[model samples]
Target: MTSATLGPLLAEARADGRALGAFNVITLEHAQAVAAGAARAGVPAVLQLSQNAVAHHGGELAPLAAALTALAHAAPVPLALHLDHLDDGPLGRRLLREAPEAGFGSVMFDGSALPAEENVAATAAAVAFGREHGLAVEAELGRIGGKPGDAHTPGVRTDPGEAAEFVAATGVAALAVAVGSSHAMTVREAALDQPLIAELRAAVGVPLVLHGSSGVPDEELRAAVRSGMTKINVGTALNVALTGAVRQRLVDEPGLVDPRRYLADGRTAMTETVARLLAVLHGAAPAVPSARALPADGISPRPR
Candidate 1:
């Protein structure tokens, strides 16, 4: 199936009263794995590339964009390519300008680390940029600590009143509110404030987004969706799966110099992780059909 725009995907998820899984893609392999997982689960998914990831790959988003767009078209389920966590003002503006042309469904302009007024101002700018490009915009309201190469600082939970004002000021398509979830957490121990989420939902008209969701337990994740979160971003869990798989592969085969072999293992592990997350987002059992169940032509079988 061809990829759909982010607006429609999030709108549909909201209409259906379910949260859409937005997985972070750090490499070409990660993009493929996320697509394959969505195909296997027969659910729509978003493949996102963080600004940090783009920087890590030498500040070129074109290669990863091309790969994700191709996978989006090839997948059995609807997919969306998103530019995630853009912090640098100039680079963020450039990506916001180039993303729609490059086939991205959405762009998340993160200015959470900035002062409240600056964050609101910058996010409003990004929202305006997104409007000109006819692309969806996601802006962060509260600080979710744990950026790459940083010490883990607990997130300062978002104030419902502030969140409402921020969304109104920015005209963002989605609002990512911090409800006690932190980035890069390997353990599922983040305590979510459902009451805050509910309050924010009441205050903010747009869909609520939860970042650093990998640390949120399954129960909390489900509760978040029930409470009003429309988009949940997962990163650390996928990174854990990918790295662990690669490490195990190398340990099992000590002299393996081929990048493809280890990367393939990592991809497989990431795919499985995505499948489980999709199942949870869909509120379905995790035993979904595998990718192999898709027809040779790459179309998934209709549900019985």
Candidate 2:
């Protein structure tokens, strides 16, 4: 199977008035679960590898990226490989330059914390490189909540006027704007600003992404899609589910020492989480996303 790009999935979801679900991968099991869950849900989705995740894998990108690309190719549903939140440093620059070669279809160049001029200029350069290298670039403007400083308060929201100008200046394929979500939240009580989402959607020509979506409840997430969010990014929720399952498994069997036993259960839990979230993005709550048999080619029938 050929590798899938992020644009087609986002475009299809936009046309159907839904959103694309992008889940972060931490370990090999996490990547496997994403593929299995997307196949189970029978929907196109994205698998993301963040900078932190890379650092966890010994600060290397190639080995894991190749593995992720292989998984994306094997899935019958269209799956995209994304390098999420490339931090600003030498490692970030190296990753940005090697993303296409590493089999990534898209990358997010994070310059959100930089000064206004530097952010604009750096993002523009990344976007230009992306255009030449056949990779979609995502950029963030407003300072979202949960940045580990400033007391985790959302002091700045993406002004519609400013967002329009930023997109024009940077030429990004997608823009992750600040509405009301935060990163790495294990709970699900974050209330998104739907009105702001609609306003930003109207302001920017590119697709808008909602980062830190694990904290959002079902109804709020649905409303976010209705307000014109094209890509909904989820990271912490999968970890929460996996950890809970692994803990339970160990409790059930005290003598279980083999890593595979608990990790298998964790993988299953993550897969279920993926399928459930994909259903939310599809505007179909209470999704019947249980694992099912597929054809020999490992492709599930595409949603109409």
TM-score of each: 0.90, 0.92
lDDT of 2 by residue, 208-298 (tens): 9999898788888889999999999998878877787787777778899999988888888889889988887787657443222322232
lDDT of 1 by residue, 1-304 (tens): 7877789999999989899999998878788889889888899989888887888988877887888888888888999889998885777667777898889979999887787788888888888878887889998876676676433356567788887888889999998887888787776777899988888888889999999898787778888999999999998778777777787777778999999988888888888879888888889855544323323332221111
Clashes of each: 0, 0
What TM-score does candidate 1 reach? Answer: 0.90
Whole-model lDDT values for every prediction: 0.82, 0.85
Error of 1 at 105 (Å): 2.3
> What are the runs in model 2 whose C-alpha is more than 4 Å off?
150-152, 287-304
User: Root-mean-square deviation of each candidate, in angstroms?
Assistant: 6.9, 6.9
